[model samples]
Target: MRLFFPLLLSILIFSCTTKQKDHFEADIIIYGGTSAGITAAVQAKKMGKSVIVVSPDRHLGGLSSGGLGFTDTGNKAVIGGLAREFYHRLYLHYEQDSAWKWQKREEYGNKGQGTPAIDGENRTMWIFEPHAAERVFEDFVKENQLEIHRNEWLDREGGVVKENGEITSFRTLSGKIYRGKVFIDATYEGDLMAAAGVSYHVGREGNSMYDETWNGVQVGVYQHRHYFRDSISAYKIPGDPSSGLLPEISPNPPGKNGDGDKLLQAYNFRMALSRNPDNRVPFAKPANYDPARYELLARVYAAGWNQTFEKYDPIPNLKTDTNNHGPFSTDYIGKNYDYPEASYERRTEIINEHEDYQKGLMYFLSNDPQVPEDVRKEMANYGLAKDEFTDNDNWPHQIYVREARRMIGAYVMTEHDVLGAKAVPQPVGMGSYSLDSHNTQRFVTPGGFVQNEGDIGVHPKQPYSISYGTLVPKKEECSNLLVPVCVSSSHTAFGSIRMEPVFMILGQSAAAAASLAIDEGIAVQDLDYEKLRKVLLEEKQVLEN
Candidate 1:
């Protein structure tokens, strides 16, 4: 009896020490449940590798499935592989008559007539509802038999374990450890990359840093129609400086043109709203609603900036993927400067504040007496989609983190690459979107008029190749890590590469590279470029033409 008891005690101790529930091992460990993370896991599994997806959020597909149903697809010819497959699946879903729940299929097609969902030659539906996109991403995971651990955030401070400048494993806030031969930082924030001690950059760089035309603080360059057409006062009382600045306007001078600053472009939720009364949930007044917060927008309304409904791009089932539009619209200018490096708690606060600001803006427009009668009555028809984001009160679970920590990897892609001035040495994929950046700050002009700074939208001459070196870290920093979402690129270059389709393309390429490196028993930096390129081509990845 004593011998049996001792054996049982030893077994229990061994079980506790070796087979811990918190420890998970795989061939590749991907952080972030973004579009990139899902594609990466699918690719890794396709290559006969075991992969685990550790997502920071409960829902998958980051911005793609969040609320960005209206895709920012520039020159859709360049999109290939898993990214294209994703859109094709959406097309298949829309083909089913049962897919249209709130509205008739004929009604949606008629409204979305010119949009690619019906007009594209490839038969891929680029426009979709938020829930439809989420379902496709979920299907990818399920079809691949990939392991996903959602709502598991990384412990950025002291959770990473490294060996000789190589990431061995990382722990989450839940004390769960993910050990793998290679790791991919697919999060928009690059939490895993920073935690693993990889070098990265935030904010805009000076024009001289890469001899680019648009990189730094562009105070006067208004490329799109997002700027005010007429003069608007910054003060509460027109032409009275003593009246103080209206809400969301800075009192400081806009920075010099082409000079570097730590300013980040504004961010807001990409709302999936509906006008159908049967399927619409009215925009609620936020718990912290303040009428004064939208005074700038009220002035914008007074100036006849009537483009509020211009960006309510149509999707399936009579829904719209509404985005930021107009001079004083959804973009919360200058409020997210610290978001890339912010702690989880601080980021949550920032996100909540943005949500409240946008919510109140909607409510104010629909109900406030300051808003014009025509605009207010028109806005009253719109509301959040009743069937979308059911778990999160019909609000988008993911915020649009347009740009974040960009890794300064083996190659730093600059405007020279994006503008087709420089040649790609080792092309892994291609991105064709325009170099676009939203306003970074809103300040009073020297003439006492309100203005926005740092919004650039220069179209690239042609589709540009994404370099392989942009995915891997420096050999001395981390040998077995890949950063697909936040690749090595300048602020101006990233403006083009930050699209959801591009992220999915990069994710697939990064996973393929990682899988090859594991098979070759070498660091990701040491993998042969030709071999990786061959595999990517076989998989129908669109590189340089």
Candidate 2:
């Protein structure tokens, strides 16, 4: 009788635990808190499907809420559906008088990238503050009642459990397991896609691989103002090889133009600075500040380069969306080659290093006596926005992950799509931005002068359609996974497609396809494109216009 009672107790405990484990089943599982992830969750809810957002980040909206307030929306007419809706919501928020806190509406000039700040006819605002963008994303979560488990880091090594090429369940670092029918990898790094054994590509592809003009290593292509205008010695002491190269300068020579290499473009913090004295916080020097680290920048200034504040793109309320401008600025070139596949600890170290480099650059520009006087005066006028990103000492919580592990899915969007040389089958979204790639490496020329390489900016013919095939993995690899942010595209093509608004559009389309796949009991790749297109158009997604 004692053994019988104990056995019954054990059975009951097992059943209860099983029931608890099955509690989190959802129709769609979004694996990031990026803007794309939030949009996916919202779309899934609209389609009457249960959705959960399992994010590794503490905050939502990735770079959108991070410091990228000046939206890189090229040909905004191509933006439609939830992406346009988001901008409209921003327009509504800015319409209210209360939104203008530090600066008044008329006082702050209404200007944007060759357009008005507010597009009245389109009912959207292209520019905004970071906090306002975060609020809109938070509103989506609240209104949809999304189940988001923030700070839930995935167990990349042994977290995913698959059955017949389908992700049955995934366990987090905290030992919590989540099961879902369809999974969307909306992260910039494509972590879930990699975990699910999806095929992906990193770094630039050779131009010959895709018959692309700008796909590979560009050694002499100086398309932007971010390069040295004159010959600058790479050494700490001018014209001396024994003086050692300055910090961040690669000793290796840049490869042949249009050749392939594994180097990645530079990364920088898109800082939000306030010119308003009432709401400005002085840029604090990073904990590991080293003045000697910026000798290269000092040399650039000494060589008569003075366009430092050219990229302080303005946003609302007298705040500027500061980006990398000159030859030696915010970008930590050639320092993040392993970030796409690095361990968590390694990635954190890289992030901290980037933060230190940028902070040190700001300190050097604003306070150092070596900087040009006019440039120093202009930089001193700006400081971190006090009301922005209040959690991380007024700095952005998410780093700008420009391009990471791009899924090599069923169909890759190459330069032919951007140039209208090839027809895009099963259109999901559109991208119109230029093929813009920042410098990947700073190498010494054969003439013994420092120069930047891999910066290319080629504008597309027009707004081009992004294929649905670019979002799904190969059928043999993972049948149920969808990757929106890290879609299948070459490095140069991805530069055009890797914008926040386009990501939101792709996220909505991915959710729509996921819902259809669940309803039809088919794999994500096998879902009918005609049915998906009908639903997307019905939802006001502009596919062909």
Candidate 3:
């Protein structure tokens, strides 16, 4: 009987070993299925390299399809290469008469980002529906013949196998292993970068750290119309400190103007809403909806704040890409401080909390009796688009991760590079967007009123170049890994560099460098910049103004 039991145990061990022996090999392994990851895979294929994309998301385009249809493109001329091709394809899709299924082509307005939505001369479209954007990304994958494994999450705890400061392979939560010569961490959260023992920063760095302005906590500087115009009491019973501060407002005083803190910028879902009665799904109350949580918004409305519909930016077919607007609106400030480094279970909780809060805000404005009558009437015109995000019950599947773990690599992009005061060596791409950041926290001011802080907007003198060194890690950290989404940058500089188009550009450049490194048998940090620049220019990337 003992001999029989030992033989059974041996059989079980052999079966387990056989199952774990499967490993997929490639020249480059892209760890995200974001827009950047797709672009990187395409570029690597174009360079005659075998590549595979391991995506944690089921969706293709990150935020481009996840509800942020209103693109924040600062200067369109600087957008070239595959990024420009993506917008061009969007233009082609809208040219077809059948594309306008919900609304007539003539009825849809052509206004977006201070330009016409359909630019016939430039052959590009800036605004579109969520479904249309997703179609384009899927088309890219199909046309490129790229291999993508979706819904596969990386094992954050001890999943990365490294040998002498280089990643040999990585295992997923499902026990699937991928071996590659090079890796690109294209995720917005920088999960692969963090797992590979790379140095990164979480919260806002003090202005003194980079020796520039707008890098740290911003208290009194109000750059947009998001703050409260008039002083309003934060208490439940108005002006009585004994009643205690209302929900969502922090009791702690906002620190001095420029002092830094561990707080991060607020994150909210960019909802895709429709005004067309046929396509609109009325905002349903979330399962965990609580009306008392939005008491501060009711008070803001009572104080004559009525900008609820200001940010209902228009897209195609009468759909709107709705974002956070005004004081006490959608952004749940001070609630995401621990999200960057939290466990998967904790991150899911945070995402669910944001979804519930935003969903509840919509219901409160459209039906709550305490809300102002005129504001409620305006909000009643909008609802979730029935044709978008169908698998997730008409809600976006991806949350807007405004900022996350930023790698501190060989080169750190600071405010000097963003403001065009410093020359960037080994230029890979360009960014012209304003240095924009959302509010990080809502706290009581010294005057005993609620105020939102950490919002800053500073524009560059001209389109500035991003360095290639920002994409690769230091020689001592990891030799084969490249990070494009969370590139090395100060808080203020990353604001401008964090645009979607810029991410695509860097992704392509990172793949090009990776291919060159493999062909020359060199580390990513030791690749020839001149050769990379020649290839990037050949691919139509705009490196210099």
Q: Locate the minimum summed-lDDT window of 10 residues in model 3.
A: 252-261
Error of 3 at 531 (Å): 0.3
Candidate 1 runs further than 4 Å off: 1-11, 14-19, 109-115
TM-score of 3: 0.96
Segments in model 2 whose C-alpha atoms lie over 4 Å from true places: 1-23
Candidate 2 clash pair list? none
Instruction: Provide the global lDDT of candidate 2 against the true structure.
Output: 0.90
For residue 402, what is the lDDT in candidate 3? 89
Ranking by TM-score: 2, 1, 3
Q: How far is candidate 2 from the true structure (C-alpha RMSD, Å)?
A: 1.6
TM match of model 2 to true structure: 0.97
In model 2, how large is the Cα lDDT of residue 373?
87
Candidate 2, residues 193-226: lDDT per residue as tens digits?
Answer: 9998999998998899888899788877778888
Q: What lDDT does candidate 1 reach at residue 443? A: 94
Using Cα atoms with residue i matched to residue i, what is each candidate's TM-score against the true structure? 0.97, 0.97, 0.96
Clashing pairs in 1: none
